[model samples]
Target chain A: MTSQLFSHDVQHTLDIAGIFVFALSGGLLAVRKNLDIFGIAMLAEATGLGGGVLRDLIIGAVPPAAFTDIGYFITPLAAAVVVFFLHPEVERINWTVQSLDALGLGLFAVTGTAKAHDYGLGAVASVALGVATAVGGGVIRDVLANEVPSLLRWDREIYAVPALAAAILVAVLIAAHALGPVTGTGAALVAFALRMLALRYGWR
Target chain B: MTSQLFSHDVQHTLDIAGIFVFALSGGLLAVRKNLDIFGIAMLAEATGLGGGVLRDLIIGAVPPAAFTDIGYFITPLAAAVVVFFLHPEVERINWTVQSLDALGLGLFAVTGTAKAHDYGLGAVASVALGVATAVGGGVIRDVLANEVPSLLRWDREIYAVPALAAAILVAVLIAAHALGPVTGTGAALVAFALRMLALRYGWR
Candidate 1:
């Protein structure tokens, strides 16, 4: 009885895709911090899986997808391997990384909200979880790297706002019983577009 | 049908006590960092409940005890209030603070292991979760304060070792069918004593 907006397979794909991109950011940060390979791999895994793990725990999803799904566990390692061998090339494409990160943020926000709602959480709580799913891993990465969480810092480009907006849109669409694939994708696109615009315009 | 080692009421009481002490430490740090009142309260709550919340989430406890239990929610705020007006005096009593923190470390280790075991996790995973329950809040507090986690910093006094030892002992006792109230209390005391001795001897 899965809703169209909650296309289970598509959501899984996006979740894994987002995790890979986030892991790349984490790996890049670990390299910049002069961490060894182990540290890099650990950061990659933590950054990629931390948010989803947190969200799963809060929703009472035991063992978490990170622990249960081999793909979820291995994707970060793959990202780490990629980063370790070609970090110099990876670092040169900061814009590309940011764009992918925005996409990750958007996908996580929409999917996370949908999943939370599926678990019978109220809309507001679902939206909050969605934002957490979008940004939680980066917070863990910063903590491990001894940096202040960008989510809490005012100097960073507006990150959580777009996620919050996208999550809320999904919640609204769900409440209105109109959360088909088109609107769901639209909600994610809104986050991506807003984030890209913020990056381009140097918003906050 | 609770086991002697898993006395539910006693566990809840210890959890609340540990949370309060942890919150005091968090509030003290916030005060030192010149955070405002709201920030102080937030830190207090986060520091007090963060570890337990993490444990609960991993073990499939929904909503978290922090959210479901009024006392769990309020104890940290009370600690924050105490810290707000009396931080100077509180800081002067660092020995007392360390002692309470050690006791918290011990209680959380023992109780966390028991809870995870009750949830059917294997002994090793239960022990790991126990240590996490003991130290996770401090890590969160330090991270939010923009300090490197004392857990990861070797320069700090030995911390995780005692918690780990306590948790392992509890797991072993459970496996041996000897984890009654007496042995459970003894396990907690081991962590407390180890931490105290470490502080006294400047174990790093």
Candidate 2:
């Protein structure tokens, strides 16, 4: 409400960027599952947009942006196409994909929080939605691929924590009327760093 | 509209009844998974409400009835309790549960389609939403429980087919100006009978 977090343009671009990387992960998983092309695309779209779509539905944003925005809808399909032909190469670059995925998680957590806040959800609910938005795609991907949600499995290294923390931080910043582009970027970076560190050190 | 399909009251009641049976399936799966009470409750709610929630979101019904209606929200919790305390007994009555589940599928298919139509969707989209509402919970339950969705598994008896057929029939009835309580009942009965026959005759 004050100066805002990310500019509308930056947020839109980042959202699409996040979808691209997340869809890559999903499409790669479909390859591992030996699914057909349709299956690969299904996983791509679900993994890329499931989180945001779920948040929008819960917060009363009808006809979610995934349906309305051609870019958002098409980016994941493009990723699917990329993986359809280059899965072996994509698989070879797993670390790079993971790094990009971490960035997507961070960006989505903060942006999703801001959007949920804009929709008038309370702080706790907003943070919850933010964390959900960050982790939802992966959960959907795993579920569709017939695996337990890695995000929820206790044996898995911590994943949702970083998003949760980032969302909480964003909520606090909002409460203080101190959320702006700089703080938002810092917040996202905090999430990214937490996720990378968790991966490296094997948190939980 | 030519005098419509169902009274809102009947639709509301049938919707809750469907939630009860679907939630039972979810609760049973959670028990099989050895999940704790919280997991049981989570699966129950997800299974009971996931489909309707998905449809509502797509059709622009914000804060879906699952959240707004206390009955819709609590019925699944009640189902979880039934499964929690009497799982062994419930399992013993598996055929009964399956039969009731088939009935729920039929009811939800018609009701979900009708609701989607009321929201001003086209016939195709309405039927699709109806089918989603009928099958959505089981998909979520299976996904959450980390198993392949039975509805999508080729080896399983034809599950989604019945719902799809019912929804299509409802759409036809709507188009023909013949959808009233009598025809609506006939459509739901058609779905239920088809599902039962499929299970009985090993249709897949």
Best by DockQ: 2
- Residues A46-72, candidate 2: write the lDDT tens digits: 999999898887878868899999999
TM-score of each: 0.63, 0.62
lDDT of 1 by residue, B36-98 (tens): 565577689889999998998888778676655667878998999999889999999999999
- CAPRI class of candidate 1: incorrect
Score candidate 1 by lDDT.
0.88
* Clashes by residue pair, model 2: none
Model 1 TM-score? 0.63
- For all candidates in order, the CA lDDT equals 0.88, 0.87
Worst ten-residue run, lDDT, model 2 chain B? B1-10
